[model samples]
Target: MSATLPNGSVLSLATTYGAAIPMTVLTNAAPPVATATAHGLTNGDILEVTSGWLGLDARPARVAGSTTNNFNLEGHDTADTTKYPVGSGLGSVRKVLTWTQISQVMDPATSGGEQRFVNWNYLEDGNASERSKPTNRSAKVLTLKLADDPAQPWNAVLAAADAAGTPRILRLALPGGSFLYYNVYVGFDPEPSLSFNNIMQLTVTLNSAARFIRYAS
Candidate 1:
């Protein structure tokens, strides 16, 4: 989920966690306890305890449970044995923009429906960083803050069989990848639906102008 920290700083699920632990992906209540804002604990975020492994209101740990659960930082899928191995389910698309910036991107949309989806430019999070080790470099994950506007909110675990209602699919298009994996919270069978309730991922592609407007009135 997306939430602005106490410092008025936008903090997504993408944070620094020195170790591994259980990450609680809550779908019902996002506003959180410590703060008043509705925060969404989602991809591109990390969770850990500062005092021990799970502390209350401690550093390096955001109050309440959102992205705090037994994690698999290796970038593996617990179910997908073929694709995402066990040791490769950690880390995901990085946050690219903040909530305020995203608001600007949404201002141009004409339809309240389309406006909810990638109606705004899918500002990428995470960026490549200079490798600390010799002959090694990494990407710097930017901070992204996407919200479930009142217009729409996806709430359900999706599956291949689920094609009736059509849910807003949140896909992370990596720069260099043949296949794209939409962010699935609950997972297949118990497949997690999109964020918006009314919108489902449309296979039909969107034109340049339909997706992004270089100049908006």
Candidate 2:
């Protein structure tokens, strides 16, 4: 077993995205296959998916077994038709084209993504026994504390994203090259905190739109 520290980690934001490739069909199977005519996506390409299925929409999926018209979502499973209904799973995929690094990041905190459950009890139970089943998970929120500098170029980008209120991609690169990517709507707090001698700082909240995708080095 091994572990690595996050001392050298970096954070980046997606600056551009390729045109959406319409997915004609998504199979209900392990490692679900997506059908998109002339997709042109190569194996190992990362795609930002937008689908009708809540479990799949706005998620980042890695591509594999790429063919002219189809490719597999590397580790996704959509076999449970109850959650991912047939004929309603069709959506589009967009490739993240570029990323801009956000420097001077101080402390990053993540919250939420807690799994929710449904509880049930018998109508007439002398023993008072209850059962529970897991349901959908909550979206995560990443709050980043940064040294505020109005002159930073990326500050303008963050402002624009907050103003647009559109979901974009955020990538966190760990020390050993592993990455965690999220689909989020950027929230910028315009006011910075004032202190005695400490550096001026501000916080930016990344409200996740879907589950995060992790890639090992």
Candidate 3:
């Protein structure tokens, strides 16, 4: 029999534990157009920028608007000449989520997936690729099968309905006291298969865009 994690594993945003998301600064627009690539922030979302530009660090700002690859900060009307200056790298920008929100308990049948990339090698005297080599090891992903519960904390994510702007972090603890963390985009599973009076079921795919950091008990 295959062992699996129980349904009680927690899925909470990183902000809940005061962790911040790291973002790369692509444009140093004036206050009216502070820009970063793929920020994953929604309008009115609170953000804290740190460690890139001195002017932006350690300040609480609100997002005015954002596209899939860009975001503009609200109320910052000045630009810094040294903004993202030479030798300066990216900063950390975290979208603050409701830390106090309850976590949604996933139903059974939730499955995990892995994406591994490998490359083949061949010798001039040999046929096709004689051997294979590992290229990249991606994060482990989980598909959450959730019973429809309008009162669940995940309901807020569903109601937001913003994909390009909002992303979250999920922390899952397995039966053996091991933990896995994933930064994911909660695509609104708007169309769940319907049944006759059975409890409604919705499936949300939590793609791990980053490394699956693990912790042991």
- Against the unseen true structure, what C-alpha lDDT does each candidate score? 0.24, 0.87, 0.55
Model 3, residue pairs in steric clash: 38-69
Candidate 1 weakest lDDT stretch, 10 residues:
208-217
Residue-wise lDDT of candidate 2 within 102-151, one digit each (tens)? 89988888888799999898878657868899997787888988898888
Clashing pairs in 2: none
> Which stretches of candidate 2 lie above 4 Å from their native place?
115-138
Per-residue lDDT tens digits of candidate 1, residues 121-207? 223524544333233223112222223332321212122213333222233222232222221121222222275554322121111
Over 4 Å off in model 1, which ranges? 1-78, 90-98, 102-217
Relative to the true structure, candidate 2 reaches a TM of 0.84
Top candidate (lDDT):
2
Q: Which residue segments of model 3 deviate by more than 4 Å?
A: 1-7, 14-90, 93-97, 100-123, 126-129, 173-180, 196-198, 215-217
Q: What is the total number of backbone clashes in candidate 1? A: 59
Candidate 3 residue 78 C-alpha distance from true site, Å: 33
For residues 99-133, what per-residue lDDT tens digits would candidate 3 score against the true structure? 42325434534334544556566567466755655
**Residue 44: error of model 1 in Å?**
12
lDDT of 1: 0.24
